[model samples]
Target: MKNKYNLLLSLMVFLFSACSTKDEVNIPSDVTNLRAEARAGSIMLRWDNPSDLNFLYVPVQFKNPLTGAIIKTNVSYLTDSLLIDDILAKDGEYTFEIYTVGEGGERGGNTLQVSCTALPRTPVVTEHAEKIDFQVSALSANASDPTEGNLANLIDGDLKTHYHTNWHEKIPFPQWIQFDLKEPVEGVKFVSWNRNGSNNANAEEVYITGSNDGENWVEIGRILPDELPTTGGAKFESKMFYKQDMTFTKIRYNAKSGVGGKAWFSIAELEWYKTWVVVVDPERN
Candidate 1:
């Protein structure tokens, strides 16, 4: 009876030990569908969480291609995305690796790896039209009406209004409008919008010129007007020109002709831009 009692006690101890070992052995699930995106100065990473309930967190590793510096981050299981910002480095490829961890601290067998390139930082470009003043050579008149063709309409940000050359007095070719940017800029870009709806008065020959003091101007770019009339009902035509880097405070548009020889030049809107650059560092501001 004593030996039988001892055998039963040993059996109970062995069963309890087996159950505890099974509970402590955690199996981690691998993360899936890892994706990466490149922004202006950062990279965004995303991945699908493991379906296993034992998932606790993810360990992410990033390596700088140039310096080989490794960065490690522990992400909560609840989040599926992360943004690594302010990566200030020369344009080059970078690498990433991800490992999933289980509740019991077990790492997944499979590791996710990805690569992305950092583009060189360039100057930011911003619109500078609102700070400037403008003037036109002539204002078009309709049946002795003068309110429809003011030069201010060009920069009012309204496509419905327009600046038109004087048609009542037969304004000659080479009609022009100019803007004073208030300060000189390193470079400039122009986005010009033609009259909307069916009007044959859109400028056909457009010339962009720039000057420092509004006197001796230099030709920057030109757009020859389309000779053929558009078949669709009058729609606004937009054109863009990127000028070389130079110091200029004034920009001028010289229109030589109108679509279908309408003997008038009209502009619906205009936008101006200036460029700038930024430097970045991953470890510092």
Candidate 2:
């Protein structure tokens, strides 16, 4: 019988070679129109590649929903876009995944999850108030008294001009005065007045210092003459208030001793105050 027709043609060629090796895999074609964008520490992805031609590459995966930590990458199907910044700006959301990879690494059709959110690392303050000016050699009297001495007449917001420091030649006993707040300044509030009447070259052992490079000085308040106040004219006013907001750019009014035993030291007015904090970063817009 021709060997039973050659064993039925060899079992029909072994059932067509087991159905062609079980359909030889080949799933691949899912990666199109996915998008995301949540900046401010980063998160930006986009996609649309898989016209299949055996596409080949686009595996990206990133999940760190609080440390399940897993981050892989491979997006080059001609790059659609991706920029996930290392995660963690107080982290609260992140889990992106893409698919479609053929050329044998076959993994396609459905896997494009996305959910990102990051934009708030805190930053947006603004305040402003100013009053600090006295420039012109930035005054720095160590001994004035050239006839109503002019250390810019003690900041010129005048209270009847006065500021005599060198009684014709006598500069002993810690006599000082400095200025230059050209910049740097923190919550400082100082005010002064004296020399409007007879307090005998007033300005007793007062000490109010601050510096940001005039050689490290930092006291910031002190007064004497019995803390001023003697019945009106606000008693030779003085009001230092630096609640420790240190950040001076320079301001020194030393005067260790004066008041009758006078070696020279007086003032009519001087003022200072600054408050300008502006920090904004609401995702840069």
Candidate 3:
């Protein structure tokens, strides 16, 4: 009888220990140094993650500024930053609430809260007040067709002629045409015409870069393949609107490849214009 009683006591103690362990829960610690930074049409949130091993994820809650919808997102514990994009510019501010979640679905007691106003959106150009022609001081190119079409033909104002890259021999692509403006021109956009009779030789990938001293250049604009003119004898006027004007004296046009996978390309004419516009601030209105 004594042995049986001892065995029953041992079994009861094991059962009690298992029940206590299964019911245990761990609550996560709160994030630290949480902050929000405002950007144009977007808001950036960053924080330092908690060192607690039980931390599994974070929940970010906000109301859409453009639409009256509740936004809730789950972020991995390993991530410490988030970018909320496509937010509309408004007179009111946005509020954000963030908290941590633990492995056992326990919520952290502390929640971080912040309010921020995003930067103003880029204003649309209601009208082009003026387009002043800018003079090119010099012209250069990496490769030209040996048989016909000289570099001088690019600015000669003749639609019948063109400037063609080497066709007799294969020239590795990224063929370029560069020009220097007599002086720095601000708020500039360019117009380029394709070869008069054919579009097959037009560049598919185009990038326009600008430099003040002609040594170091920064990308000012890019022309997508669909944006390039598909029909022959057509013109492509850059539609990229700059929020802040860029002033430069030198401009380079790089052709990564020609249409239909050809190595050579052609341009009929190139022109630059100084644009003028007036934007009324929404707050002032």
CA lDDT, every model vs. true structure: 0.69, 0.73, 0.80
Sort the predicted structures by lDDT, highest score first. Answer: 3, 2, 1
Candidate 3 lDDT, tens digit per residue, 87-129?
6567458899999998888899899998888887676555462
How do the residues 1-285 of candidate 1 rate in per-residue lDDT, one tens digit apiece?
999999999999999999999987877888888888887678889999866645889898987776788889999988888888767446477788997898878888889988886544444444333223344432222322154567668777888787777777676777777766656765555666667774677777777777886669888777665632343224433333445566777777777777778777666776666533344443343
Candidate 3 is scored at a TM of: 0.52
lDDT of 2 by residue, 67-118 (tens): 6879899977777888887454577888787887888887877888878786
- Which numbered prediction scores highest in lDDT against the true structure? 3
**How much lDDT does candidate 3 score?**
0.80
lDDT of 1 at 20: 98
Worst 10-residue lDDT window, candidate 2: 229-238
Model 2 RMSD in Å is 14.6
Winner by lDDT between candidate 3 and candidate 2: 3
Pairs with backbone N, CA or C atoms under 3 Å apart (clashes), candidate 3: none
- Scored by Cα lDDT, where does model 1 land? 0.69
